[model samples]
Target chain A: MKKRDHKECVSALLPVKDTLDLIGGKWKLLIIISIWEGNKHFREIERSIPKLSTKVLAKELKELEMNKLLHRNVIDDFPVRIEYTLTEHAKSLKTVIGTLHSWGLTHRKAIFEK
Target chain B: MKKRDHKECVSALLPVKDTLDLIGGKWKLLIIISIWEGNKHFREIERSIPKLSTKVLAKELKELEMNKLLHRNVIDDFPVRIEYTLTEHAKSLKTVIGTLHSWGLTHRKAIFEK
Candidate 1:
């Protein structure tokens, strides 16, 4: 590749690498989806995603919070309750998630049709 | 969660899970990006991705091909040259990749500003 092309490729890939670094796991996006779909509490998220253990869910949620994708809120009531909500930054992932969801549906249909 | 809500969550997660199953790793999307950016040869891709090993690259390439995201073309020359190209299906990931790339840029800026 030419020096210019190489530079371009590097520039193009930097953010992509960063994005993957943020959301490249099996559960992160799903967790985001779960919260986006209105499952805010810990138990709700846990029950929503089948096979995701509490340990993994907790870890993923903390990471998501740290990244500012979602924020955690604690209710001061007779019984303390926590809610997870997506930030605008996280809500921006709707396009990415929608594209993946649509592509996945097509991919699944193609595989099954074969 | 109510019974209806549980069923809705399951339906919503199925395709997302399938999508993750297809492209969950650190390397697959990068490999696709590498090819899309004009790194068609094995050595070019390896050179472009700073830390990718040959073994991993080869494995990713095969998986991408098997998933119909790309195709391999062998040129019948004095010493056989192999070229990899993205299929239409793979090209469709542009929106997905673009979204990630844009989000990544913002995400990186946000982190640095913190």
Candidate 2:
């Protein structure tokens, strides 16, 4: 890689707000994590996540697909089947989510209950 | 850590939306990353981040402090100075944010322009 300047490097970052803007919705991250468990079909994702209205689930899924974080493959059949997978980009979120999970554990014990 | 069951382990993870709920706002992660650069105090943080309205900065800082991600130590003196530092819990985010930065680079090259 070529040597990049400080300004160049900083500008290269995904704007933090844009990052959140893409994944910040109420269902985006959960939808990603739900698919993370290998459930892919719409009904499967809906079933895995309790109380998720179909409308919201569809909306979130389309958004995730648009952002390239999740892939929606439509299987041709009597009833179309859609399977979702984490893009390589979305896989990067695993580390982020893992750290968040760790923080949650620590926060639950130390901060939340207090 | 004790050997925990599947449900217990899963429950231990923060709800993904809640994680976003805490840090997924317009200014939260930027505020965190701004403070990540060793700039402390209301003024220094303000100066480091351009175009950030003071009201929003103050509000985000207070929220970050309440979440224990940032510390506000008021220095008792003539003018009374306050500084912010990332808590140890916040340090865990380094890996997560680093991964995000890397993904941004790759995404810019591979996906965003397409």
- Tens digit of lDDT per residue, candidate 1, span A57-81? 9999999898888899998896999
Candidate 1: which stretches are off by over 4 Å? A1-11, B1-11
User: Which candidate leads the pack in DockQ?
Assistant: 1
How close is every model to the real structure, measured as TM-score? 0.85, 0.74
Residue-level error in angstroms, candidate 2, position A32: 1.1
Colliding residue pairs in candidate 2: none
The local lDDT score (0 to 100) that residue A97 gets in candidate 2 is: 72
Candidate achieving the largest lDDT: 1
Look at candidate 2 and tell me the lDDT of residue A38. Answer: 74
The stretch of ten residues in a row with the least summed lDDT in candidate 2 chain B is: B3-12
